[model samples]
Target: MTDTDWGELAQHWLDRLADCSVPGAGVTRLPFTPEHRRALGVLTELMEEAGLVVRLDAAGTLIGRLGGPESAPALLMGSHQDSVREGGAYDGIMGVVLPVLALMKLRHDEVTLPFAVEVLAFADEEGVRFPSALMGPRALAGTFDMATLDLHDSDGITLRRAMEEFGLNPDSLPDLKRNPTQVLGWVEIHLEQGPVLESAGLNIGIVTGICGIERHMVTLTGKAAHAGTVPMHLRNDALAGAAELTLATETLAHETDGLLATVGALHVRPGVVNAVPGEVSLTLEIRALNDALRECAGAAITHTARDIATRRGLSLDIARTYAQGATTCSSKSIEHLCKAVATGSRSEVRRLVSGATHDTSAMAELCSVGMVFTACRDGISHHPSELVSEKAMTAGIQTLEQYLIQLQ
Candidate 1:
């Protein structure tokens, strides 16, 4: 059904996203911004053109409805369109556009469903305005209440105010959360955001789970002294302790096999050319597919940091900032997706786990959730140099269309 004209649809949406920008191609479409509204308008028009009755939920989530028999729960598909500042073309836009294109192709072929289908173009999944991510799905799951909305961004802009600017109400959002029994399943088509698919020569991957995340902040304290006066053995340096801890984190991850850890941020108090630093702070991020391994890896990292500090005459402090449990995709939903891909392309399919977090984790709280990933060249994403093969995009659309048909 999507053979000839689907590429045209993809190009149309890609152009739409590209056009809603300044002279430079930066997508500053943060929630409540003028750019965000224009992008949503384009999405609404496209949904209507594809013959779906569309509406915006109380949380400003764009919904497109294709009606069917009244008995079965609806099968939901699609993703977000908002991008991080200057993010790649595919990250959020393709996820929503490809599914819509698939549905449009099905409609063109006169294909109907035994159950209703709704395509969602969620807003603010990146949490650009706030530190908390997955705003749209959290509200839909009834997990984000007024209390969460009360939190403010760096500019002191509350989510409630942001929602109001976009014509939504924070208090009335509970009504928009889907009843668990009313949703058959949820699916998001996204870029792999990594190199696995491209390296393995695969067209797509059926996601089995989204990894858990552990964010920590570590501080090392020592006496500040003149660099030239303090002898090497007598001097206690916080930066030295921090450097040893950073190296230990890498070793810990390798020891745990599946564990992934990084010290992405660091700050040395009184950053100067000729001074012994008195304090050092760094952020530690750890991820794993399994909870037990995640915890064990974290312990190893902390222990190593402490040992290094003790030997160097510095004191260590570690604080837990945030932690999210791992989320697994439903086996039944994954099998269904696998079959859909096989039917569409007749190619061998790969089942993989996502190393990155997504809005799918929030949806999984209310319904079975699965994802499809088109490869990004060199396994890179969230950057301007990001790339995805046109062929993989086409195959991804075909797989989604077939998946929707089988959902009946």
Candidate 2:
């Protein structure tokens, strides 16, 4: 009935995160897997225990509702439950637990919101399965389409097929899209997943916008040769061309302010020790809060790749994986969240932008959206070491609770 009890509830969710087996890690709870469903089942039980009505949609997004006055639209809060392989316990799960606990705290206070409050346990935000992020929110926003479902996972099963196996109807996905008129606003309490808050000695961060992402796959083609027979000076190696282009991208991204680029995956044809590679493929991900800046940065990288390939006597092919435009949160909702934080704690809340993608980006197109961030240990996330202290999590919950109640 007290805040301590709500804190305890948060801890219970943390424990579930540790035990849920969705992927390779003890902490990861991947979406659509049996383990993921089991975790969602546990979440349903918790929400029901807290007096919320629970339902799982056709796309597997779990919703918990606390009804309020009929005149006000719903106050929505929640985060994804899926985790990256071998990822940390907090990442997406923190967003899920805090809001639920905050709702519990409110109910204990005998407080009824002026508007209904719904907590969502998003099925997939990590994109660890399909490589396209923000699945749950996309479905809710009507942004995720059949083309998205047609993509194959690592196991060669299309996303639609996987959804069918999990008892979700992919064909009815359009129905899952939310009507902006039914929802008032969205707020997500997530770990910062970066060092800014911790390094600044801050407890919470208010997100301003979600950054745009430009993902591309680059392929280099050249003549393969016997390693012993062809000298480096005479041979045209696709792998070498790829290496040059990768470094060029890195250098250009660094030169551009606020730009981030990474070559995360790579493969070489005829992967043998004795043969020079005839073909090389690599993936590049570039992101920034400014879409124009991101586009310029991407173009620079592409130009560099072409120049490097030409000099190396290799052919280059580049294709976009996905490009998400930057999205800004509603200013009114942000003011509410900041005021709540300031009232709940003495800490000064600063406006920050999310370097990563979230479901809120999708929701922003349709309704007012905002975010709350707790300090991640060393700003590290998506790994086993990602952590946030109990005190910090409690602070975040209190602030979010105040925000939700004030929204009434």
Candidate 3:
């Protein structure tokens, strides 16, 4: 198939899934939801039509396989299917579609590789429904904590219940663990999700590493008082303390190079217009390509929160919810990706550190992994405005197809 043919196919698949999302809003295919299942069904059909054998794992991860020599370790590719609430369509979907189309193009050309290739559409990389990210890949890596089965969503649905409702048995998740020796490596073709590639005037980027992430839940408590009666000097306000800590987080991240800290969620109570907030709860997320930097930032933020609470006479508590170390792509896989980009484009293939985490970060625990990033419009991602040009998509597919051929 020609580039035009592949581009049209990609657009067709994207548009098909687009209907599963809320109209005029961004994509919201949360894990195990009806929309997510519908999207997976569409993708499964497309994969089968591409001449791949398709199956669904116990964790609801979709896998499409192409054969190689018997006893040869297979190469894994693709990304997650679930999106953050009202998120863009291309963030995770592009990774899955590109590989399927690349394989289809290979089949059309009658080319066969010596190593098997498996396309993975992970179930819950966004963690929008669950409290943690990378759930799907973590399950396959045998790192999924069974305790998370009790974790509840906004609708009061436990992860285990959600799995069962979606036709997956949580007890069977252990069976999905992949044998390390049976998998050669993983390669994900994702959108850059940032403007680095576009700024560098390149159509694609080879990811050097994924950022480490630390997530925390912070709560500040104080005595509730009447808003009008409480004197500024006498008041102990949890909301005020939280605000100070939030600004401190932003300041520290700005002062520290390559560190990013965000207070994405906040809640205040008694949540009344006439009452001074007695408690404030917020989520803190720290990320950096360097592990040391990430740790330092987390420590600094924690210290700042404590200091703010002490000054305000409010009690402070911090609970770490998640922590993931930085991950570097394997050297051999990087070499293969670079060669693929060189063969497909005249522009220099740039190596970049991803500020955002991906399913490949979890897969790195199972086997060697690498990633290719197509430039997205501006630096936008996880939003409705996220997009990639048709030309860039075509380039990504060509590069991926060439990379797969090199694996033979």
Q: Which candidate has the highest lDDT of all? A: 3
Candidate 1 vs candidate 2, lDDT winner:
2
Off by over 4 Å in 1: 1-4
Expressed as tens digits, the lDDT of each residue in 184-302 for candidate 1 is 88999999998888888888889999889999999999989899999999989999889888888888787777789999999998789899998999999999889888988888788
For model 2 the TM-score comes to 0.90
TM-score preference between candidates 1 and 2, better one? 1
Give the best candidate by TM-score. 1
- Please list the Cα RMSD from the true structure of every candidate, rounded to 1 decimal place: 1.6, 2.6, 2.7
Better of 1 and 3 by TM-score: 1
Give the residue spans of candidate 3 off by over 4 A. Answer: 22-24, 221-240, 269-279, 311-313
Model 2: per-residue Cα lDDT over 88-206, one tens digit each: 88887788888888888887777877788899988888788886777777877877766888888889988888889999888998888887888988999899989998998888889
User: What are the per-residue Cα lDDT tens digits for candidate 3 across 300-342?
Assistant: 8888888888889999899888898999999988999999999
Q: Using lDDT as the measure, what is the rank order of every candidate, best first?
A: 3, 2, 1
- Model 2 residue 228 CA deviation (Å) reads 5.1
| Model 2 segments more than 4 A misplaced | 1-8, 22-24, 130-133, 147-169, 226-232, 269-278
- Report the candidate with higher TM-score, 2 versus 3: 2
Question: Which consecutive 10 residues in model 3 have the weakest lDDT in total?
Answer: 15-24
Shift in Å, residue 180, candidate 3? 1.1
